[model samples]
Target: MSTSATEPEAADLVCQLDNVQGMVDALTSVRWKRHQDAVVELSEHGIVLIVEESRCLQAKVYLQRELFVRYGYSAQGRPRFGVSLGLFVDCLNTFSVPGHSSTIEIQYPGPDMQLLLKSLDSANACIYAEIRTRIPDMVSWDYNFEPAGSTPLSFTVKSSALKEAIDDLEWPGSSIQITLQPVPPSVTFRGDGHGNLQIDFKYYVNTDLLVAFHCDHQVSYRYKYKFLHATTSNIPASVIKDNRGSKLTIGRGGMLKVQHLVSVARPSISHSHVDSAGYQQPSRIAYIEFFVKPEEDEATGNDS
Candidate 1:
């Protein structure tokens, strides 16, 4: 009897990220202690890391291909796998140095189907890690978030201020109510428990602080404090230091969506592309999004 040899499959995806610390910070933004496992989906455009809590709260980190030094994708379709978020973040952290920068080359579907990561900047030594990944068992939850009403109800505030507001309101109660009105063009956060605390951001007060606002009718919704906190609690200090803006939008059924942009490009390694004017533009960015479900008995105050 003649035996036939088996052929090994090639890696499905390979990419090199020059700004390791930036990627770390972006991933850390969505890293929650409660949900350790995250689903990773790879596509031609980029990679997306998703983490959810009991289908009520969901967070996604988008690592676009433009953010990488080199990107290669040979997969037939979008491939997804589940891996330990804590382990992945911890491993990436080990590759970053505070004052120094490193480039990391990543590959998926290795010989053993494990996710492979290697530090390419080291001169004498090479740091490598192989994290085990499993076939995704649970289907990721997709919340159809449409505009709340005729006009989209949304507001953008400085990241630092948003973080501070959420932190301060924690002492007041277990749930926080968000109220937006068109007449006054203001957004308010109210918490009632042992004490009451209300914080408002008026559109005309300071355009720089409030950034942007849109509300057609009066709308109010209450969300659990823990869920709301999780959205901004883990935001990296670098993001806040950059004076970025965190946008909050209320969708149909009082679904709250929080969005944050994290810069993953360094001044030295970035600037590979030029615009029509021939001016070098900064590298791409990573997007972080969180979706929190409102309380069971969410309040929808006066519509007019």
Candidate 2:
């Protein structure tokens, strides 16, 4: 297909963000695998970074267009390319200094199609880095989490509390078994090797911690500690500052989805945009989600 005249050429795509470090910090949170490359997708709306580990776990960091001071994409459709995440992150941190903030401008000039990063500091110091890009693999996995349908268990908890609870657990085991029931001891975290921890959210006792819970049938499943630990480790510091929590959904197939809301920008309360359908548009909120696949075993435990 011929390129449209209105479409952004590969070289004309550029994105500029006010807080470079914030972006860097968010990406670093999900840097679990050491040598994995990330696929970068650019569009008029914003940019998305996808990092996958062994096809067992996938983490996505989304930066909305409103978060950027200036964003442009001239491609007919979304443009996707691959680059070493570690290398890209290192380049971003090269200009980092204590108590200093830098504006970041990323450009993709045509021809060579190298990813160019230009960092400008308040003191007028400019640092430029050009990294090569590669054709992203077409066969990328997608996370299709259906919270509306037949999920056996779903709940929301404070990010800090979850982090602390996970950290407090013993790591002697390779897998951690999670048990959720309707009665007391609503949630239980059991280490396969040594420790047994139970967190109860009795209605008369502590209801605040358990934001929402819906589980008609009690369920128990086992997931790798290393994969689950990565979720807590990669939570952006900003998410903690905003006092955000995470939502977890466990499907019948032993698939777990963790969602964390990351505040991007403050909304203008006075004015709100209305779509063509006359629905009021809400404020922009970006979320980072992790999809984890559970190990298959005949001893999936009793949901009874």
Candidate 3:
């Protein structure tokens, strides 16, 4: 069977692998951080957005909430709320690997988890991302997802038994889900009529950025955050003495790279494009991108 993680042929071989069930190691992971209501103050020169997040989420992994207002395309120009999005922005280090037989932890990166939160923190979002254990394709069954909580998520499956070679009694595979509760209160921002954000990176953001969070424009608001950014220069002073006091070391495989990126002009369209034959040329493309670094556990631990 194919055992490589980066090979194309591995797909066909991994399909034959066995179906598995899972139990949660911990479920009290999700947390809430802060919420900011945006407002606009018109001045003599220009208009500004006002955004204020709760102090709890300033530097912690907490929940964030924002209101996304959409204008329907019907003749009446009806306004509607698509989906109220919620996400756990931090606190992943508390999560433990599922068990001895699990390989999911060693397969993906922590940034994927963070990136997924940004995507899902929207209503009818353009993108939805999650860092879950992907089941092998050789199995025909849908992913077996169960919340660590008491509620059961339901879905329907249909397959031909008599009309096909396989029988209905056959089972394929099962996956796992760890239902979590938000730790801090979720952070929220709202838009007036324009549901877009503009991003700009600054060396220093004024302590009073809560105003920008309340934007009435068709652009993204501005905010400042701290991240661990160093390509190879961020190696920690000491190596793994133990788990109780290690943040993450660089080039060692466990270290996560934090880049200083300004997410500007997201969920927006530029008006400075060439349009011909009813096709509007795109002046700029807006989308947030994140990368999943390879596992450091691979080179160090045999079964980490």
Candidate 4:
């Protein structure tokens, strides 16, 4: 019989970090400089968080056993138990981040079993699913985090290489999720072949993950969706991505107010359409964005 599976409620503690009143009893792993200690394997059907230490410590949490310890339990008449590692990790990441964190799981699986072994385990601390928490206070002079109030140096979305895309665009940091949707073509303005049609987005760049730099520190900002040479007053509401309640308002059929503008030439994004002859032509655009911010720091040279 698996020991850990006896306590089902403990699964809830998998990915959370909170200041609890006490500690934990199971064997533990301290924060070593390199979180290279483990491998995160994700597949279509499931994901596995593995700890790869060549040498076994006194006690270590394995995928199989961690589920058992966290969700196993027993009762007087019925010895019932629940164990789900997926649910545990889901709850953990829902609350914590890919970065550093700690969590405590309490399992009180009914009566019958003696409390000696379970109660005597570690009670002073919680468990953690951690990664890079050691953000050094200082970056080498060579590195720079964009400071607030500065124009971000624009990059060729093409120049955003595979690795950069994987780091910033694909496997982006936490708490910020950005999505885009296509706006249907219109027939109000003369659209060149290069008219705006699609909206792209980047999240948690300025506020959450990349907060240390000048680009991130700024406070006043709004993002809006817009189309050139158009008045939005009479048009129905325009939706960007799936943000329903959060959308740009049109005063004139072509004009929309930009909200959440951190930095931009224009906050809102929209496309221009041309109606001539029997053909309705809409313009294609690379991408659209605006940068509305305060004066930036001199040292950062924000746009450089």
Candidate 1 lDDT over 181-245, as tens digits, reads 88878999999998999999899987778989998888888888998998988899877877667
TM-score of each model, in listed order: 0.90, 0.81, 0.14, 0.16
Error of 2 at 281 (Å): 13
In candidate 2, the residue pairs with backbone N, CA or C atoms under 3 Å apart (3 or more residues apart, or in different chains) clash, namely 7-74, 8-74, 8-75, 11-110, 29-234
What local distance difference test score does each model get? Answer: 0.85, 0.71, 0.18, 0.22
Cα lDDT of candidate 1 equals 0.85
Among all candidates shown, the one with the greatest lDDT: 1
Model 2, poorest ten-residue lDDT window? 274-283
Scored by TM-score, the top model is 1
* RMSD (Å) of each candidate, 1 decimal: 4.6, 6.3, 27.5, 21.6
Residue-wise C-alpha lDDT for candidate 2, range 181-205, written one tens digit per residue: 7775376677756655554444325
Alpha-carbon error at 224 in model 1, in Å? 0.6
Q: How does residue 265 of candidate 2 score in lDDT?
A: 45
Q: Is candidate 2 or candidate 3 better by TM-score?
A: 2
